[model samples]
Target chain A: MNDLMIKASDVGKAFGDRQALDGVSIAVPRGTVLGLLGHNGAGKTTLVNVLTTMLPPDRGTAEVAGFDVVREAHQVRSRIGLTGQFAAVDEGLSGLDNLVLIARLLGASTREARARAAELLELFDLVDAAKRPSRTYSGGMRRRLDLAASLVGHPEVIFLDEPTTGLDPAARLGLWEVVERLVTDGTTVLLTTQYLDEADRLADSITVLAQGRVVATGTSAELKAQVGQRSVTVTLADRSDLPKAQEALERAGLHPVPAADTLTAPVTSSRELAVVVRALDEVGLEATELALGEPTLDDVYLTLAAHAA
Target chain B: MTTTLTAPRTRWRGTDVFTQVLVLTQRSLRTLVSDPRMIVFSVLQPLVMLTLFSQIFASIANTPGFPTGVSYIDFLMPAILVNTAIQSALQAGVGLVTDMKNGVLARFRSLPIRVGSVLVARSLSDLVRTAAQLVLMMLFAIVIFGFSPAGGVGGVLAALALSLAVGWGLGWVFLAIASWLRNAELMQTVGFLAMFPLMFASSAYVPVGALPGWLQAVANVNPLTYAVDAARALCLAHPVTGVVSALTISAALGLVGWVFAVRGFRRPL
Candidate 1:
C-alpha cells in the first residue's frame, strides 16, 4: 500500500470574513500525482498555503508528510517546496546565486551549495545563462530557475500551483519533463492547474474543486465513467436510408440522433460499433465514418463544475 | 538481514538558531558586496554632513567655553558617527520592506528557518555597512581637521561601540515599521521624516546651551542628544559619563524598539 503524503481533515480557512476554503479535504499518496483542477477563486492556492504550513487554517487539521501543519509548521515547511503562482526568485541575483542561496538556507555548506547549484543548473538546461542576472532571463528561463531554486534542498513533496500557466506550449512541455522525473524518483506531487489536458496527462488521481469545494474526484477513467460512455458517430452514405438506419439503430438498442449527414447515438460498449455496422447493412446503408470512445476528463470537469455551481 | 529506514529522522536539536541567523546575515552581507552604490551613499551621506556642519560652525569654536577643549571638528566627529549609524539603521527598514514586497522575505517564510533571523539579517547587514562608513568618516575627521581624540584607541573604540548600538537600536524601529507597514514608500517616508527631525532637534551640530530656551529643552530631551553627547565625551576624554549615558539611552531604545517590532510583526496591519 502506498503511504499517504498529505491528509487534510475538514480543513477550513477564511480571509477577513470571506471563506476561502470550507472543510475541503484531500489526500495524496506518496509518489502519485494528484492534480487539483479548479478555476480562479476555487481555493486551490489557499489549500496549498494551508498544507504547506504558510498559513494556519482556522478550523480542522492538515498533515503533510506526517507533520501537522499547525503544530509542526517548521517540519512541514522542510518537507515541501512551494512554487507559488507567480515567480518569487530575486531578480537581482543570478540564477546560479538564487539556487545556491536556498541550498545554503537549508544548511548546506558553501562547497555543497555551489556543487548542488551547478547540478540543478544542468538539470534545468540553464548552465550557460546561470551567471546572468535573473532579470535578464526570459520568462521561461525564469520559471525554470524558479523551479530549480525550489528543488535545491531536494524537498520530498512539491506543491506546483499553476506552475505552467504563463508558459508557452514548448516551455510548458519542458516543465512537464522535470515534473515527470520528480514523480518517477518517488516524489509526491500536488499539482494545481487550469489546463484540463495537464490534469489528464500527468495526474494519477484528480480532485476537481469548484467554489472552494471538491465536487468530484477519481482516476481519469473513473471520472469519465461518471459522464457515461461516449456516443458512436456514423455517417450514412444514402440520405434515403436515414429513417431505416434510425429504425435499425433503435431495434439494436441504440438511440440515434441525426446530425447533418451523420447519425449519432450513445453506446454502452465498443461492441455497439459492430452492432451498428450490422444494423447499417440491414438497412442497405453504409457508414462513411464510424468512431467510438469514452467521455474525456474535460467532459467530467465541465460536468462537475456545472453541478457545483 | 538489514532493514531500510524509509522515513526521515524526526529528532531536531534546536540549538542551531544562532548559527542559522549568522548564515542568513552572511547571505545579506554577500548581496551588499555586490551593490557598492549602497555603500557609497551610506558612507557619503555622513561625510558630507560632517564637513558641512563642522565648517559652518568653525568660527564659533574660537569663543570661550565650547563645553569641550577640543576643536569643533573633534566635537562634531562623534555626533556625525552616531547620526550616520542612526540614519543607516532607520533606512535598514527599507531593505526589509523591499525584500517583503519582492518575495525575498516570503521565501524565508516558506522555509524551515528562524523567522526572527530574516529581519535580523537585514539589520545586521545595515549595521556592518554603516560601521564601515562611520570608520571612514572618523579617518576623514582626523586627517582633514588635524584633530586627535583625547583617548586614542579606547575612546575611538567606545565611540564606535556607542554608534553601533544607536544604529542597531534604531534598526529595531525600522524593522517594526517595515513589519507593520507593507509599502516601501510609506516605510521610507516615515523613516526619513522621523530621522531628520530627531537629527536636527538634537545637539548633533552645536551645544544645547547655544540654542534658545525652548530649543535647548527639546534638544536636551532628545535621546539622540545622549548619543552625541556621550560619543563626544568619550572622543574628547572629557568624561566616561557621556559614553555611559548615551549607551543607556540607546540600550533602552533598543529594548523598546525590539519589543514593538516583534509586536508589530506578530499582529496584522
Candidate 2:
C-alpha cells in the first residue's frame, strides 16, 4: 500500500508523429514533494495531463493513489487535485462562490461546502476578497483561490503545474508557504516548474527532464554532483600575472567562467588548493581575491538541458 | 466491463452530475446577469425584430394560400417565439469560444468531473435562458400586440415544445462550431454574421417565396424555414399534420447536430 503516491512505468505520449513523453518513469514517495523541472514543451504538462486522465498516454501505465489512471481514472481523480498554471476560478463568480461551486461538484453537502469554502478563503488570505468577483482579483489572489479550489475535495495527492510563474516575489513566497503547510499535513505534491530556485526550495527530490526524457533524477545535491563543477575565484596580485594564471588553470583541467575578469576555475578539493597555488607560484601568478563556491541550480539546469539536447 | 462492482472507476456518482450541471449553469447565468449589455441585447433585439416584421407584413393575410382575416400579430407571434429560442441556442456558441480562449473549458477537462458535463451543462444553461426568451416573447405578444393563441392551450404547449426542440437542435450545432473553431473572437464574428442573414432571408421574417430569386433558392435549404413554418401552422390555423412533420424535421436536425458535436469533442484538442 505504501508503494508511492504516484508511480509510472515507461509512460510515453505523442501527438501524431511527434513524441511528448518518451518512456518516462518516476516515483513520488508519499508525503513528500517531487519537483518535475523542465522547460516549456519538455512534456511536463503532458505527463500531468496523462496522470490526471485528461489525455491518455500513447504507451505505458501510471497510477495515482493506488488506482490505475486508465482503468480507475475517476477514482484517481477523486483522490488527487490539480492547480493549473492559469487561474481557473470561474471569473464570473465570486471567490467564495467559486470554491463552493467546485466543492459542491465534488459532492459536498451544502452546509459543508459553505463552511469549507469559508475555511479555505481564510487559509488562503482571501477572506477579504471572498465576495468580490474573481475577474477583479489580483493575479496572486486569483492563484490563491485556484489553489484553494483544488483543496475542496481534501485530496491526498495534488499536482501544481507552474503555480507561480507570473506572480510577484512576495506572492510566490506566500504560495510557497501554503504549499509547505500542505506538505506538513502529509499531502503528497507533484510540482512541475521551470524555476530552478522554486524546486530547490520546495522539492524533497527532483527529476530533471529535457526533450521528452528524464535526464537526471536524484536529491538536489546528488544531481549537482552529476555535472561536477565547484568554482574558486581569485584576483591576481599583478594584472600581468593573468597570463600566468591561465596556464596554471589549464594544466589543472579547470576552465574559467567567461564573465569573471580575475579567475574562476573548477576546484577538486580544498586540499588541492596547495597544488594550484604552488603551480601558480612556479608560473609567477598570485591572487588578491579568492573564494570557492559550488555550482548554483541554474548552472545545473542549463548543463542538463544542453546535455540532453 | 468486468469492473462494474469494482468501486465505480470515477469518484463521480450519478447525482454529482446534477451538481456539476447546476454549478456550470450558475456560472453561465451569473456571467450573463452581470453583463447588462448582453442581457439587453439578448432580450430586446428579438422583440424589436418581432414587432418590425409583424407590422411590415400586417396585410400578408390578403395573399392567396395564407389565412385570410387572421391578425398579423397572431400569425407572427408563434414563429417569433420559436425563432427567439433558436437564435439564442445558435449564438450560445460564442460563450463556448470564450471559455475555450480563457482556458475555462480546458480546466474542467482536467478536473474530476463527469464526462460530457461541460457540454451538457452549457446547453442546459442555454435551455433555461431560451425559456426566458420565450416568456418575454409571450408577454410582448399578449400585452403589447394584442395577440393570443386561437388554437387554445394545446396549441401553445405544442408551440413551446417545438421551439425548445429547435433550440436544442441548433444548440448542438453551435457546440460543434465552438469546438472546431480555434479563435473565439473570429467565431463570434462568423456566428453573428451567419445568423442575421440566415434569420432575415428565410420565411422567419418574411415568406421565403417572397425573397429575390437567389436568396429564395438559398432559403429552400435553411432549416429555420421549417421551424417557422411549423410554428405558423400551430398558432394561426389548422394544419395539424404539417405541425407533426415539422416536429419530425426538428428531431432529425437535432440528431445530426448531436452527431457533429460528439465527433468534434471525442478527439483531443
Candidate 3:
C-alpha cells in the first residue's frame, strides 16, 4: 500500500445525465507506468482530472502520493505534474521564460529558477529556441516545452494525457524515448493513450476503458492472451491443393479453416508456422504465400465490445 | 538530464500566496509587454476617445447649467480616465477567458499555488496596465490638447488613483464574468453590452442634468456616474463627498465580485 504511488477505488463521476466515469479504479506502483487505454469519450481525461485534483469524484475516492485527492488536494498537487491533452504552455512567453515562471511559482529563487529553466531547455533540446516565444515553436517543440514545464517542480508522479496524440511518427518516437528515460529515473507515470502500440511499449500494465467503465485490465501480454491465439494463413497455388493441405494440417494437430484457395488456422505461437510448412511439404503441396497474424489491441477492443453487446 | 532527475527533492513547504500572486502577475505583465501590438491597440482606443470627445464636445462646457471657466478637456480628462479604466477592466475578464481557452489556466489549477492568486494576479496586472494607459493619456492631454486642471498635480494624482480604484473594482467583476462564462467571445460580447450602456448614460460624456429625464435617472443610479463624478471632483478640486461615495461603492463592488469570482473559478472545468 505504501509503495503504490497512485490508487483510486471505485471512482465515479458524471456530468448531467452522462456518466463520464463510473466505478473506475486503478493502482500504479512507484516508478512504474500505468497505461490508461481508451478511445475518445471513454472517461480517460475525466479520471485524470479526478486523480490530479482538478475534479472531485461524484462517488468513491482517489489518492496520489499518499494524499487523498479531495481532502488533501494541495498535498496531491505538490507531488504531481500533469501535461494535459493540449499543450498548456504560455504561448506568449519565451520557452525559457515559461519554464522559469513555473519554477518561481513553485518558490525557487531567481537564480535557481533560471538555472532550472536552462537545464530543462538543454534537456528538451530547446536551447536554440529558448529565447523565442513558445508560439513560434513547431508542434513537437511546443509539446516538449510543455512537458519540460511540468517537470520544473520535480514532481513525484506525472500524468501525461495523450502526450503524443498529434505528433508524426518520428516525433512520437522522440517523446516515447523521453518517457522511457523518465521511467528509468524512478518517476511514477500514468499515461492515457488511444494507441495500443504506445500502451504496449510504455505501460507496465494496461487498463482498457469503454463507455466510462473499465472493460479490461492486465499486462499487455495478458490482455493479448485474453483475445486468444495468433493465426497462420496459407494461400495455395491451386484450389485443388486446398483439401490436401487441410488434411495435412489436420493430421499435424492443427485446425485449419479453408476458404477458396486459403487455409487459416489459429496457432499458439510463430513456431507453428514451421509445422504447417513441413506437413504440407510431406504431401507435395506447394504454397504461394504464408503469413502470421498477431492479436492486437484492436482485436482486444473488438472482442470486448462484442462481449459487452 | 540525469542530474536533474536525480536531484534531491525540495521539501514541499507551500509557497506564500503573496509570492505566488507576484510571480503570476509578472507572467501576465511580461506577456503584455512582449506584444507591442496589444499595447498599441489598448492605448489607441482611449486616445481616439480623448481626441474625438474633447473636440466634439468642447462647446458644451459653455452651455447653460454647465460648470464655467474650465476647458471641456479638463472636465473630460477625468471622465476619459474613468472610461479608460472601464475598458481596461474589461480586458481582465477577456484575458482570463483567453487563458482558459489556451489551457494555461488548467495548468495553473493543477499546480500547488493558492487558487485566489490567479485572480488577484490578473486584476493586479490589469491595474498596472490601466495605470500606464492613464498616464500616457494624461501626458497627451497636457501636451497635445493644452489641458490644465485647476486642482494641480496633487489633484491629478488623486484623480488618477481614483480611476485605477474603479478599474480594479471593475476588473474583479469581469473576472467573475469570465469564470462563469468561460468563453472569450461571449465574455467580450457581454462585457461590451454592460460597458456601453454604463459609459454613455453616466456623466462621463455630458453633465447628468443635461440628459433626457430617463437617462438622467439611470445615470444618477449608475455606478460609473459616481466614479466619473468623483474623479471629476478630484481633478477640479470639488467637495470630497463624491470621492467618499465612489470609494465605498468600489469597495463593496470589489467584495461582491471577489466572492463570486472565487466561487465560479472553483467550479470544475
User: How do the residues A1-309 of candidate 3 rate in per-residue lDDT, one tens digit apiece?
Assistant: 389999999999999999999899998999999999988999999999999999999999899999999999999987788898889999999999998988888778888889888988998899999999999999889999999988888888999999998999998998898888888878899999998889999999999988789999999888888766677789988888899998999899876777667887767778999999999999998789998877665556655754564
For B1-269, candidate 3 gives per-residue lDDT tens digits of 35664233564444889999999999999999999577668878889989999889999999987888888999899998998888999898999989988889898888888779999999999988999888988898899998788888999999999999989988898899899999988988998998998899999998998999999999999988999988998889887568888888888888899999999999987
User: How do all the candidates rank in terms of DockQ, highest first?
Assistant: 3, 2, 1
Docking class of 1: incorrect
Task: Name the regions of candidate 3 deviating beyond 4 angstroms.
Answer: A229-296, B1-13
The order of the candidates by TM-score, greatest first, is: 3, 2, 1
- Compared with the true structure, what per-residue lDDT tens digits does model 2 show for residues B161-261? 78887888788878878777756677667767877778767777556666789999888877777777787777765676546656677677667767776
Clashes, model 1: 1
The pairs that clash in candidate 1 are B230-B242
Candidate 1 lDDT, A266-295, residue by residue in tens: 666787789999988886778887977456
**Per-residue lDDT tens digits of candidate 2, residues A1-309?**
575999999999988788999999999988899999888988999998888887888899999989999898878877777888888777888899888877677777778779778878877888998999889998888888888888877777889999999999998998898788778777889999988779889999999887679888988777767755655677776766676687776676655442336766555567656666776777766767677666654456545544554
Top TM-score hit: 3
TM-score of 2: 0.83
- Native-interface RMSD of candidate 1: 5.3
> Model 1, B195-269: lDDT tens per residue?
888787888877777777888889988888888888877887875676677677777777887777776654422
Better of 1 and 2 by lDDT: 1
Count the clashes in each prediction: 1, 1, 0
Candidate 2, what DockQ? 0.22
| A152 Cα displacement, candidate 3 (Å) | 1.3
